[model samples]
Target chain A: MEGMAIRLQGLRKSFGETTAVAGVDLEIRDGEFFSMLGPSGSGKTTVLRMIAGFEAPSGGRIELAGQEVTGLAPFERDVHTVFQDYALFPHMTVEQNVAYGLKVRKVPKAERLVRARKALAEVRLEGFGKRRPSQLSGGQRQRVALARALVGRPRVLLLDEPLGALDLKLREQMQVELKALQREVGITFVFVTHDQEEALTMSDRIAVFHQGRIEQVGTPAEVYERPATPFVASFVGTSNLLEGESAHRIVGTPGTYSIRPEKIRVLKESAEADQPEHATAVGTVAEVVYLGDATRFLVDLDAGGRLTALQQNLETSSEDVAAYRGTRVRLQWHRRHAVAVPVPD
Target chain B: MALITRTAGALHRRPRLRLTLLLTAPLLWLAVLYLGSLSVLFVSAFWTTNSFTSEVVKVWSTDNFHELFTVPVFRQVILRSIGVALAVTALCAVIAFPLAFYTARVAKPKWRPLLVVAILTPLWASYLVKVYAWRLILSEGGLADWMLKPFGLGGPGYGLTAAVLTLTYLWLPYMILPIHTALEQLPANLLDASADLGAKGWRTFRSVVLPMVLPSVAAGSVFTFSLSLGDYITVQIVGGKTQLIGNLVYSNIELNLPMAAALGTVPVVVIVLYLLAMRRTGALSSL
Candidate 1:
């Protein structure tokens, strides 16, 4: 990218015995909404805290707009953070909270107040400056926390699970609002989250972390469709994972594979000779789930665990399913959709 | 809102029979043991003493109160006692603050209880024994003199300094525990958030720790003031004529009970004013 907002090289951090971030390296483009997604203990939050300067990297260099910020104090860094708890000073009013950094930077009082009012309006919290954090609801407090971080006009914004504390509906609302916020501001953003859906909905790109390493970095669809490891594939969405024996080798690669349950199709009766070719697995119908638009079924595989198959409820009768439960059946999926991922040792 | 408060209030308003039963024991004790005793003192304070007979007469007089002020020693004693108590409170605050801060904020979890036990072990011992032990060290022909004999000085260190020092030692832990409790309960994240915001070290201490612990300071002051004010034994044992109000009250009551009653009113009034000021500030209610 022509203007790199933040470039981290070999960022490593450890707490006494536990190494949290181990040599993470990346460059976030200017005006990009970059997200770090991972399970707990995967060091995504540690990376965000390192960028925010709440934590110092044991071995690495962090650059923002071509200037080094690794040794900078949290306030000294040209980055602001929205914490998961929204860490608003309960004693201060909304306006005072937003004006804190500006006042510390010695922005003149008149100018600071104007900037604070504008920031409050940015988060749609205008006329709420007099209220304390305790006086506000969860959503309003989150907006106040955002305004406090944003009024400083830092080069980069770091959001650490900022919507995690909200309920489901509010989380969806804030995700859309945050996406619009990022588009309007055009500042580089480094968002950290454990929720795969939030990361997919908001990010321009996501770095999926496992243990202390990035397993893959790509757009949401790319990572979902072509997950490089079993962890990423299983973590991203629902799947009917399968283990298969090798056919005659073409390129001699290992042959373990997985397919989405939705890809499996059910046929009413046994077809004789000419059926569209796909690999087939036979099992007995173990269970069925009738979701509104689709019906899902579990097929007890001969090997062990059940294979899930999701079928559309295109017909009202489900006459085909009348014979499904406890009935022997064959399932098939297109060979191409069966993705290959590295199996762990 | 008013209706909800009334409904809640109804539940709490004491039932007439239960209230009367609960009030009976305390009311009886107060009416007889307290009020009855105070009535005798009040009457005795005004009773005239026959000049030659050395017997108290039932006739009313202001002579006891008159004698209290007419004597220079009693007035000096009153002022000295206040000075000693105030000094002890100030000393306790200074010594207790760092210990309380360390216990509440800095010490690790395992070591914290150990430090608390170490600080409180002195309190577990008998108060009389502790004061008596100090008496031996401060006396002229005691271990303090024995220890100083090598340097050719044998002197009585037992005076006003000894009394003040011993009183502070005894009550210092009392002052510390309440302050420690208050400081411990203060929202710890508030301090962490302050530091993360840009304030470091002492700035965080001044803005967050101090304001939140003001109630504790008020609590500690209450203990130190009330305790040292009522304590005449330490002064009499080690004071060696370094007069205090407590010692003055002791001698006046011993010499003439009516005179002592007149003298005792000073501390009672001071304590009442202290409580009133604390209440007005909402300091006591905050607890």
Candidate 2:
């Protein structure tokens, strides 16, 4: 249907003997912000390249707006990509870089220039059009790259770690701006990033990739709270994974379970499980990590495994938490917060 | 030994003295020997040769330059030499761009060093040997004519064309190396970004690849143009009757030393002008 912007069925890619993307099936909805979150060598970028028609799938069908486009060249595909390196032409001015796609599409020079100016304004780079890409700062060049890709108004915009090069402060700022820009353009955005926080902050739905396959596809909350596999449990965020004897003793089940560190509460040694739905474990504090806004407590559980608990620094300073090291404490969480995950082969 | 150590300590403390000491020998060579001969040649261009006695007289005159600009044979040779240089440069560029692109981008990574070595192998042979080899190829019933005989066409025998061809062959490695380096340094992501933005292969090449490599091409052209402009031996070996500025200078060197120096200045002046033009294209900075 028209509601589906992109569809990949049994898509696969291999380089010589190495399989980069084994098999992937995905459908990105129209006007949705979708993210493929994975580590390096996990094949997330390869799939994005396939959708952009830069790499042909070894065995798959790629349909864009319900039309089969697996055999098309990159120029023939109605998609644009913002590269991680921000590959703006160094020879051209910012205006020329932004107007390049329109020029390729045979848009008249006058009209393309006006559209380029508008795109630059959208990225808040109105007066910087005449400057060369080399003259701009890293963040400004990033904005120019965005303006260049969006000037054509393609059906789907694929961004491959476009913000990965920036410093953390600028990256966070651009993340907010990019999300706002995606909403305003109402275009399908397939973002690929290794940073889970970036994916969670921007994507309406996230597909977590591991090895060469999709581990889970769901909303950020679902993937973080209820991971489908043990790999997804540890990758999406920090997780307290209990398995085998530890799982049976603490969770009352003989299987793997993932409980988020933020979900577990570090309490006084004499604390009791006040609610019937609470799961409690007693442990000695092994390590105390003082993050600025929150303190992390790593407890060596008597039940045979270690569990990490993140407590907000409300009334405690670094010295106060540092003194908690080697002290006895109780870790408690709602039983529902711990979800069962499948064991990896 | 104490004096040597004290001098060393003094040199280390004085950076300016150290830099001056480091540059003294090279500066002496460049200024006294290299530029010294060039200035002497320019100064002698103004002196005249005795017509009857055939002896050098230290009398300054503009007659050599006057004859250089006004004589029909001299003007024709100047123009023809410039034309041949331009033609050779153009042909080298036409051949080198694709060859360099393939060697730099399209070839397998393992083959790249081998291919570069192959290009450089031609340069290791003596220049005269290469030109003489071309001489045999362009001679009557040689390889070129023998190959073209099946097509009922004759080879371009020893002439301006033969001279240009030999010069292009001689200077091609120079052109290929710089452009190859530029292309190799070009990031692969720019090409992908171009295609991803809807530009096809040729369009990407024209708008992205060519502009970025123009400085390198200009750098290569400097070698090709100057080398072709001043060549006399290749023309003599394979040029048949073609007379370039080098031949004119060589012939006039003994009998008409002033005229020979004047004619030599023509190539130097042309090269200087060519360098100015290339500098406008931002080539010298890249070089």
Candidate 3:
């Protein structure tokens, strides 16, 4: 069995009257890329900070590598964090910044410099060590921050939205690079991010957080396919929620159900949906949004609700899909695609 | 009114003319009133004083500078002034760093501006009044002695130590302002990142906090050092027989104007050299 890298029991933090992380219990396996995915103010960052020992949990026990580390300072713990802003020391050269951890640990100067350079090379930043952080571009600075955190080789690396500042293209590129680096290093990576796509693409397992509590903990595919709660269904991706009359009329149920937009296919009103395992609804296409690679059709069903269906733009252009608005259409998906999610209080 | 409108239109059309007009007054003030007098001082420093009738003499000579360098009393006073300036700057830094850190980083945001105003309140008081207050405090059996009596200790009576103490108090606001600004602007995440990198509090302070705020410290020291170097009134009031370069310059103004100007150039030269050293540390860019 894989060892647990980090474990938290009843982790809670409150700033005065407002609670940031109400209660969290999690066990992150060693060498796994675990993510806490949530929207801003959902307490994901507070949880990450508490695990890193930058913040003291108001009521909880934190264990790192099976040793209780509750109330220990960040320096005393066996973890490191990559700040969102990069937080590269402006005064030091890139090498010195990466070597800071080793220097603090009383590592020999020559050995630390060698390890710093090796870490930099791992991030593809060789020979850039003499440059100051201000001299490097945004993406380069990000790699330097990554290298600096990795050079210490801590048991668990806590990253707090480290790519939040980068542009879309750079963020996508670094996401891949970070995933590969985590796999190569074989250290537990606990990534906290509000970007659902980032968490979905990089994390081995994800814990969806809402209002300071985990909504669900599962693999990315599981979280995406079978969301545990209504919040998770909407937050992780676009979900066409059906409830009450619509749920009864279309889904043949009287509870909340989440259907992924991509699962439903839009067809002409007269198109046959004869399969017994498929759920079909007749609706009018109220709006059509052209998304380059895909087209989103917002359908106002006659059954008393709106459903969104995504269709690939393989044989259609923007003008062609734009002409689909206000047309009568039929949306069909497999019956099992509509997952019943627990309604929130 | 038409002429005014035409002139404004013309100025708007020509950016260079507009900029020149905007800068003319300040440029004139800086060049003529400031640099003009400074050049006059430099030229007069090389001239000598007539000894026979004690009349004005503008003949160019290095006699004053020669005496300023050779004379034992002038050398002693010059060294003493520099020593006091350095001591005051060091003490101001040691005292102001924690106070400024508290005001900027530790204090609640609502109280920051009020704390800054409190630090600046002393500057509104008359300089002579402040010096005289220090004079009273440093007097035998005064506030200093009264405060130290419980510890079985007494104050260092009026002298160079008194001058350094008074100057440190006087120039503390100058030191605190820049350091406070720098500390306020320092990102909190850097501290967190430092700690996350396995640096303890003092290590983070030395590696992250100190280097980042050093330029501001140098900026503040400029104020404290130069001001302390040129101060003579505080010495006269509370310094108790201490003679600084400013005292020599003030005493020689009537009898030996050239000698006084030469004496004045010493602090200016020292300040220039100090600025060059600070610039090497990249302090000027932050300033």
Model 2: DockQ against the native? 0.92
Off by over 4 Å in 2: B1-10
| Per-model TM against the reference | 0.78, 0.98, 0.97
Worst 10 residues of 1 chain B by lDDT: B188-197
DockQ of each: 0.22, 0.92, 0.90
Q: How far in Å is the alpha carbon of A48 misplaced in model 1?
A: 3.1
Tens digit of lDDT per residue, candidate 1, span A221-338? 7777777787888777665566543321211344556567888775433643135556666667888777768888898765545668888888844555555788777777776667
Per-prediction TM-score, chain B alone: 0.82, 0.97, 0.96
Candidates in descending DockQ order: 2, 3, 1
Better of 2 and 3 by DockQ: 2
Chain B TM-score for candidate 2:
0.97
Per-residue lDDT tens digits for candidate 2, residues A42-101, read 999999999988888899899999999999999999899999999999999999999999
Compute the lDDT for candidate 3: 0.93
| Candidates, ranked, TM-score | 2, 3, 1
* Most DockQ-accurate candidate: 2
**lDDT (CA) for every model shown?**
0.80, 0.94, 0.93
Q: Model 2's CAPRI class?
A: high
User: Global CA lDDT of candidate 1, please?
Assistant: 0.80
lDDT of 3 by residue, A1-345 (tens): 699999989999999999999899999999999999999999999999988887889998999999999989999998988888899999999999999999999999999999999999999999999999999999999999989999989999989999999999999999999999998999899999999999999999999999899989999999999999989999999967998998898887789999999999998899988698998999999999999999999999999899899999899999999999999999999999999988878
Clashes in candidate 3: how many? 0
